[model samples]
Target: MNALTVNLRSVLELTDEQFFQLCQANRDLRFERTATGELIIMPPTGGETGNRNARITQQVMNWTDADGTGIAFDSSTCFKLPNGADRSPDAAWIQLARWNALTEAEKEKFPPICPDFVIELLSPSDSLKVAQEKMKEYIENGVRLGFLINRKSRQVMIYRQGKEVEVLESPATVSGEEVLNGFVLNLAMIW
Candidate 1:
């Protein structure tokens, strides 16, 4: 889905509570908060995009479930990165140790931690530049691994810590590498 970014820093700074309340009151739109306090208002995905996102999330969740090493999250779950940015990756997984360290109250709100792995599936309306920026932000926030998948161009930009991004063209699948251990995402459904 395409997102409408509102630069509220010029108008007024919103407290964490205010941002949380605003998000809760507008359940129709998906929201994200940047480290700079900009609000990203994303529209609901179209049917095709929604189905693709679901498949991606299901695949990741299946691996996480069987591996029993981490917890999987869908698009609706937001994570408050250590840098203070609230982001919602299309598919994400945090290591069991990291997740267990969170207090119950923190878990109830946006967990203040970065996921070990994250996936962003590009919808038709999504801007590639914006998505790339988001992926970079994830990496800067300490995400160990991230994937920016573009079905239109059949390309995937792979991001890993301490390495330059690796771009693939028309790949049939994406490997989880050492970070995800045994997880290998099958791209047939999403592609």
Candidate 2:
């Protein structure tokens, strides 16, 4: 006898409240919003991608923990942008003071404010153009620093306020500068 296999397609397109409710009900769902406000729900990562992100998040956490400068969150957390958009960056960092000012309930809910630093990791399914546009949205919405990490090319593009975006090629490092003092990330180690 031969066994049949089935692959369940993920959900796509949802209302804002429906998206939040779905996320609350399912801890494993990874939700992202497009420029057109459509919701994309994806299954959790399986192997290398998950491991790499875990390591990178740890590095970010360690740096923040030591310096007491910011708080970091993995992709599961969502940030509410200025334009009524909800974004889930691969990783995010918010300044300590700003984070501390929120009430406990506010911390429990989706943050209504922008993060100081946002990081997006490129997956095989992601479009670089779309990712760059999302990064620009974050910057325009008050994100002081943003990094787009492309594992395929081992490059990181740094976005800062009132300046041209800077791309760091392989073997270089990215810093948070004034946004997150003493927070430095080496792309070589991350990829």
Candidate 3:
């Protein structure tokens, strides 16, 4: 299903705590906040999408465990971006130093720092244009590397800071490059 965006700036402005409480109350639903204060309600992904997402997250988690240089986060974790937007990427990783910098209280709420690496897998109901825009926003907010994987199209759009996006079509695998050290994502399971 497509995401629904609601502009509640006039009726009510949700503070950070209010938004967090709202999310906690609605445990089954996923929500996001735009930089402009709009609310986004995202529907749950289908079984196929969920399965693929699990594989992707598992790979990243394994890498993080072995690399010992960063922490991996699943899709359910929302981050409070530098630009005031609350976003949740499919799979994300933050450097150890950056994560250690946050106070215990800061870690209790939505993280206030952008991830060092992010992955957004396009599901059947996802919009490619919208996903691309989100990737750009991640880079602009200090993400070092990102992958927008469109499984239907078998295309992976690589996003890096200060560089043009690179598109790879039907690739067997995608490397994490220097960002994740020796990490490489195998596409066989995803495809």
Candidate 4:
């Protein structure tokens, strides 16, 4: 059997302004700001991982509409955090009320607010520790819910404010609980 070679690049630490400029320059790079003020820029996904993430995002979006909660967005969209940081999740959601409260201009421009829910799909090249830290940061920054989807193990870890983190393994369904009422996503379907 032949060994597969993985090309991993060193993570470049960046300031908030530098991170913004990097984002502006590279349309394909995805950036995540760590709680300790480190910036991680990752290359775009290819092959199975990308397809799985896209399928999961679509499933979540469909579940949101079927549950009658609000709108869901794929990774292409970015959310502006309270701090001067902009990060994109694999998937995001916003309730109708909070979204409607935004001004037309705010809606048109990047909404300077945290998403109601965030999902991070793990890639082979991703650092699990870094991803989990980012998810924690999102919760601290006012994201009501977060899901860390690990494709390797096919597990979904759910995070909520003032509660213990819940790990929902494959063959189980993850629910939004009260944060997004009536929204239930089956892990098996997406995985």
Predicted model with the maximum TM-score? 3
Mind sharing the TM-score for model 3?
0.99
Instruction: Estimate TM-scores for all models.
Output: 0.97, 0.84, 0.99, 0.79
For residues 25-56, could you state the per-residue lDDT of candidate 4 as single tens digits? 87766655544455555677868778878877
What is the clash tally of candidate 2?
0
> Which model is ahead, 1 or 2, in terms of lDDT?
1
lDDT of 3 at 18: 97
| C-alpha lDDT of all candidate models, in order | 0.92, 0.77, 0.96, 0.75
Error in Å for residue 117 of model 1? 0.2
Candidate 2 lDDT at 47 equals 75
lDDT string for model 1 (9-122, tens) is 988999877888888999887899989999999898899999999999999989998999999999999898888888999999999999999999989888888999999999
Note the residue pairs that clash in candidate 3.
Answer: none
Candidate ordering by TM-score (highest first): 3, 1, 2, 4
- Using lDDT as the measure, the top candidate is 3
By how many angstroms RMSD does model 4 differ from the true structure? 5.2
Cα error of candidate 4 at position 94, Å: 0.9
Candidate 4, residue 167: how far the Cα is off, in Å: 1.9
Residue 179 miss distance in model 3 (angstroms): 1.0
- The CA lDDT at 77 in model 2 is 87
What range of 10 consecutive residues in model 1 has the weakest lDDT sum?
A: 1-10
lDDT of 2 by residue, 34-134 (tens): 54565656556657778878877887888888988678898888876768778888889998889999888778777777898888887766678878988
- Runs of candidate 1 with Cα error greater than 4 angstroms are none
